[model samples]
Target: MPESATLPSATTKLEYLRKDLEDLRYYLDEFSAFLPL
Candidate 1:
């Protein structure tokens, strides 16, 4: 019962982290287009 109480917040944190990573990747991809290999 105690573990169930903590699960929602932990899942929300994980979702936020995943969204941050996706946003970071998008910005990096955009920046990389202007750089020459």
Candidate 2:
């Protein structure tokens, strides 16, 4: 495979992973606030 193709695939995967992580963090924060004391 060409390096150009591989580079974009890697970048897209990284972008998706970062978005997933951010979403997870937001969910966790909301859950924490909802927990009882």
For each candidate, how many residue pairs have backbone atoms clashing (under 3 Å)?
Answer: 0, 0
TM-score for all predictions?
A: 0.90, 0.83
**Model 1 per-residue lDDT tens digits across residues 1-37:** 9899999999999999999999999999999999896
Residue 11 miss distance in model 2 (angstroms): 0.2
Go through the candidates in order and give each one's C-alpha lDDT: 0.97, 0.95
Candidate 2 residue 37 Cα shift, in angstroms, is 7.0
* Overall local distance difference test of candidate 1: 0.97
Q: Candidate 1: misplaced stretches above 4 Å?
A: none
lDDT by residue (tens digit), candidate 2, 1-37: 6998799999999999999999999999999998985
For model 2, where is the 10-residue window of minimal lDDT? 28-37
Which candidate achieves the best lDDT against the true structure? 1
Q: Which stretches of candidate 2 lie over 4 Å from their true place?
A: none
